[model samples]
Target: MSTVTVTARGVTPDDVRAVARGTARVVVDDDARDAMATSRAIVDRIEADGRPVYGVSTGFGALANTQIAPERRSELQHALIRSHAAGVGAPMPREVVRAMLLLRVRSLALGRSGVRPEVAQSLVDLLNADITPWVPEHGSLGASGDLAPLAHCALVLMGEGWVRSPSGSRTDGGQALAAAGLKPLALAAKEGLALINGTDGMLGMLLLALHDAAHLFTMADVTTALAIEAMLGSDRPFQPELHAIRPHPGQALAAANVHRLLQGSAVMDSHRDDALHAVQDAYSMRCAAQVAGAARDTRDFAAQIAERELRAVVDNPVVLPDGRVESTGNFHGAPLGFAADFLAIAAAEVGAIAERRVDRLLDVTRSRGLPPFLSPDAGVNSGLMIAQYTAAGIVAENRRLASPASVDSLPTSGMQEDHVSMGWAAAVKLRRVLDNLTSILAVELLAGVRGLQLRAPLVPSPAGQAAIAAVGGTPGPDVYLAPAMEHARAVVTSPELRTQIENAVGPLS
Candidate 1:
């Protein structure tokens, strides 16, 4: 693994990706000490003047007007963390939790949020030392900036939540803090608000979703080519002229990618006019350029939003360089929340469309001369008949989860959080959509590869055949349908196949 010093201003999306993949580590920059000092002095000025700050000297949410005596302010901060640590659901994946830590660390390092140097360093120490909190997957509104989820993050700094050590699970934060030899941070000034009030959940979810979408967009194109050839469809629709007229970047790219994948192949070239007898291929094939293109466009747009959110200071009562502070809605999740919903919609469509193509591959009427249900002895052996059913089941679930959570908001926090973007729901559903798309595409990959093999000696383009060869040569004719589905799911989800294909063809742009 490589180590990278992460000053708030210097972190990039690539840096976050490296952290997510576990190929890199993060540390506060040497200059951050000065930033921390600036933060501390700012807090002093706020204290000297006795300013009323949101989530600082006052209470939170509906209780924002409630004041705490200075003597109890420190206790107030700790109590806030402990009280808001109310996440409930299955624990988030280790990668997601780690990404949250990284986001919090980056936000603090920006030096815009009014958190003390100790608070920022504690975040750094927790991440660098791997003292991550086991946060739950749900319980966030994506407004007031993922309050509950982030509070648990702050709790880990206080040494009270569940954490994993080399040995086993430990609920005692003190023991884990001592074992790691890390000290608890004194939440000076606006530290609690700085800790909990941010869009880290939405940010983390957006980054991971966008990253996966970019990879999967490439996979979708390649998989579609396999499906096209397997179905004996015409390649004319992929001609550059159609995409050139409309000139959508993602559409043109999809068309170009399909053409490249189909280059130098007997299956495609020999059957160049093969579908002349039919009016046009189904939407799955005919509209592949458009559907896949839309998804690609959305993914790119979402990536932009993720980059912006990652660099931003998302805390309330933002601390300035001179210790003057201001309350603001920087904690609102509207920005990334919208993108999260968009991402879920696109990903669900990706799966929804792939499911249609898989249906075409399995259907008795539409599947060319192949055996019904993809089995030679259709009556005796079910073959992939039920696999298609399972794919349908998954696609249905994706559709159900695809509803835009950002559009629907319910008030909480005594209506103070009215119009809360359910962006958290969007994140959760996008995750499900990603998983469903992988499975849906996997089933199609299996069926398409089988569809390709059944055509024997009529192999696809060099790129296509090479991909086939790389997927462990071709399986035997009697291979069980279950394993093929499993294999296809693995290939689509694994970055290896996607990366290899891109390497073979070079950059799209």
Candidate 2:
């Protein structure tokens, strides 16, 4: 029921999350309205003078040289929306649609897009009323402002497309608007181009993906702590004195978390002097900080890029305060594309390392004293043996998904828009990669928790105990593995593990 008053500045990732979840209403501030009015005057001047403005008076893209009379200008705007709303395949997730709407509104509210204040207000109204457009999954080239996907969203503004109700049921946009006590907006000069010409689609997904990544990175630390306890690995390698010599901030942070999580672990204490074991643990067990730390640093870099994008004005032919409308290449998505691709590479490596830990925990030879596959009777129960396989499968898939989509450019729009960024494709795949990483972490938690269970009377640290409790008790012989894995996945993906551990220990980095 609460609302977020959006200004020309100060929108954050958290704001996007709240609005996308339908828990917050958006209202434009007076300053943004004033700014928008200023831009609208410029557009009005261009319209009256019949100036050869890029989107205001002439056709778009390859047809830019063509001019139209004042009478058909309205038709030009309508035709532009109809033609560009060419997205196909399954409708995008409702949250993504909502985010697209919000970001588009934000971009226009920057007052550079030359739209009437009412046009932005209508989008805010649709969001407040919970009428989300049914945007499709494909059609953007990540250049020309996420054209096709955003066009689908703009279609609903004019009441010419479909939308989803608050209950997530599909309905006609016209019907939804009528029921919500609203009317369809008629497009004016430069409004159609204003709606579709931005990087909102790719940027919105990256914002959500970054939000999820923040939690996943913390979970990575929690699960890594559990893996170390289960493997009876030494924490000596994580010493602050050692990390200070070759300080990567992320590595040092990850090491500090491991040290804190294993502070008073009796399991680690029990093996501290066990000369029977090797002097050092395997790389997956000891080098978790190094690997996961590198991933964290890469994610931080991506977050920096997302923050910059949040502050940018992404439209083309932006209206200037000096009363000139000029075309520019701000619509190209190269920055977002590179960030998404780089983050995917980081996510894939984190999953790959976590899967290796799972394999080590389940292998009898590698696991030291644990029973084969961590099953009470290895022969009778497959006992998460195939869980490791599933993790491996997803990890391999992530490797393929991590192949940067941004590098593969194709020509479009009569080759007028060549060498596109493919940023939208990169962002879409990054989301999938993050999802796979969650599952991979869950698989590791499943086996790692069981390993700790077998460790028995020798208890883990408070943090490790919290993670073990979150994953629940180890399974008995020959039970259904899928449900247990799913439960573990739910625990791992949720904040339960982190909350319990943070409450027990001071807090994790």
Candidate 3:
């Protein structure tokens, strides 16, 4: 049980992933607590002075003009959480909900959102207890800081919403808290607004997607190298000299990875100087590094945006050092929306190109003398023929998902929140695209490894041999294609396989 300290400086993408996917504990640092106290003094001053500050003494969006009496202010905060917990769909994954809790704690711990230190600690308590609030998948428009999703989380803190207990059973929020030896929080002035007003949901999903994409992208490069050797294609196109002249950073890195992976390969050496054997390979084989490189660039660009968002204070009516509370539009999620949408397009392109390589590996004419479908018995076994179809179907779906959700906006809150960001939608779609890309690469690995085995005496490179050993499914008269395909997919997604490959051949880009 490792612990991640949340400070005013904020946490990293890795920190988010740890708390989200692993059993890591969270702690708010002392400096962040002190800062929260300093900010709380300002909020208290506003309340005592009887000034109508937005979110502090007044109403929320589309209702900001209506002022509430001091006696009714606590009720106002309670009403906000109850009204906004309006999400309706299947409950979100536990990891995603855990991430939202960690991120909201980070936002409040930053000290910009005027909240008592206890408010932030309550979220940490929920996380430490492994109590996940039941957040529906379809509430946030990704504007006003993923309001609906965060509201569901806030409701749990107040012991008034549904939650999944540590034992994985659905239970009332109050019972869950009591079972974990924790107490529910009482909302104060501006506390409810502070709890829900942040881009934690979409941002959490983006970070997780980026984490998975990093592994998948490297696997893509590895599979492309295997495909080249399996197809008896020329590796000349991956020369550093060729990539250096054009000098796209990602292009250079991708080319170098493939070049390194193909070192000391008997298959590539067999037809090195035979001009008639392969004067030119097809676009999928020849331009693999180029397509994967472009996707790498896109992933890096999205990472930059995510890093900046991680350090942001994404709430309205932020407390300033000058003892003033100013309302700002920092809650809008446009930046996160664009980044998720861009990454979706990149993932789709990578998967689409890999699908093409899978098709080539199965075709007798294009596979350079390999048997049709790589079947051990030509007519008796269909081999991995249907696997290619599965890959193609997923690629088609990914193309549709790549359509930018950020570009489509439906106004809400009586048009007070005109032009919502829809970042949550974009992030959700990106997750699907990444999953499809992983499956697509698995199909290629299955075909490519079979092709390598078909070449017999002409062995693949060291890294390629490691990949073959990792996905040890012998090419023969097909025996239950579904299980073999699943095994290949599991190998494709495993970190152990990537570690094995990198150990054999240095490190991939």
lDDT of 1 by residue, 379-447 (tens): 767667778888899988988887888888888888877878777778877877887888888777777
TM-score for every candidate vs. truth? Answer: 0.94, 0.98, 0.98
Cα displacement (angstroms), candidate 3, residue 111, comes to 0.8
- Cα misplacement distance, residue 312 of candidate 1 (Å): 1.5
Each model's Cα RMSD: 2.2, 1.2, 1.1
**Best of the candidates, lDDT:** 3
RMSD of 1: 2.2
lDDT by residue for model 3 (82-180), tens: 999999988888999999999998988889888999999999999998889989899999889899999999998998899975566667988888888
| Deviation of model 1 at 116, angstroms | 2.3
Candidate 2 local lDDT, 1-509, one digit each (tens): 77877798737888898998658989999998988999999999888877799989889998888997888888999999999999887878888888888998899999998999999999999898888898878999887979999888888889888887657677898888888998999999899999999999999999999888878877887778788888888889888888888788888988888888888889989978888867888888788888878888988999999899889998988999998999999999999999999999998998998999899888888888888888888787878889999999999999999999999999988878877999999999999999999999899888878888899888888987887777776657877789988998898788877888889997887
Q: Could you tell me which 10 consecutive residues in candidate 3 have the lowest summed lDDT?
A: 164-173
Deviation (Å) of 282 in candidate 2: 1.5
